[model samples]
Target: MAKSGNKMATLLNLILVLSLVLMISIAESRKLGEEAVACDSVYGAEEGDTCESVIQKFQLGADFFLSINPNLNCDNFFVGQWLCTEGTVN
Candidate 1:
């Protein structure tokens, strides 16, 4: 019974450690994505990409994005669309 309990405790500890590592890895990837340089650069829209997500990834405000990209359809996203990022950067 004691050995079984110890095994369970070790398994629980391993699970916790793995969970923490996975969380950290996810966070780091998000951080790297958010650090993209969009200022004065033209970005091509990828599949499943949204204008809001792109703006957020570049740390841009809606107003700033609009000012740089005149006549842009920000409400809808199209793959292969070119986006100008003049005043938007992380």
Candidate 2:
């Protein structure tokens, strides 16, 4: 009986953690952009791609690249994500 009770408690804790993660993910996605924005120029981040490397590849500066992508972190994006290379109206 104690073993079963421990399992139930563990399951409940797991559910609560998953729910909090899901809620935070939803909020963050909305913050990033609710809808996709059209891109004049775009870059698909490949493995080991960094802000400096990308800007160098495109012949742009760090400030320019970061400026075009507001609310974005230079080193916090996932691989294979597409980013706008040019600034677009929201």
Candidate 3:
């Protein structure tokens, strides 16, 4: 009985650890995606690109860019990055 209880406890601990790791990984991935610089426009976004260039390509202004990507920095952009900027009104 004691051995079974220990095994259950170990299993529960393992599950908890795995859950934490998964949560951390998900958060990290979201951060990386945010750090990336892709436009959220369905019309003009490729797999690897930056939102800055996309906004330029689309002829959008700085305010428009900010309105679109609230979490992004206009000055700093990265290559092969993607950003979500939908539902933003000009």
- Highest-scoring model, lDDT: 2
Clashes of 1: 0
Candidate 2 lDDT tens digits, 16-89: 99999999999876856443445588889888888888888888867667767666777687888786787555
List the candidate numbers ranked by lDDT, top first.
Answer: 2, 1, 3
Model 1, CA-based lDDT:
0.77
- Taken over the whole model, the C-alpha lDDT of each candidate is 0.77, 0.78, 0.64
Which stretches in model 1 have alpha-carbon errors above 4 Å?
1-39, 87-90
lDDT, candidate 3, 58-79, per-residue tens: 6767566666667666456565
lDDT per residue (tens digit) for residues 1-90 in model 1: 999999999999999999999999998767553334444687888887777888887888877776677667866878889888665445
Ranking by TM-score: 2, 1, 3
Q: Residue 19 of candidate 1: its Cα lDDT?
A: 100
**Model 1 clashing residue pairs (backbone):** none
**How close is each model in CA RMSD to the real structure?**
11.5, 10.2, 8.0
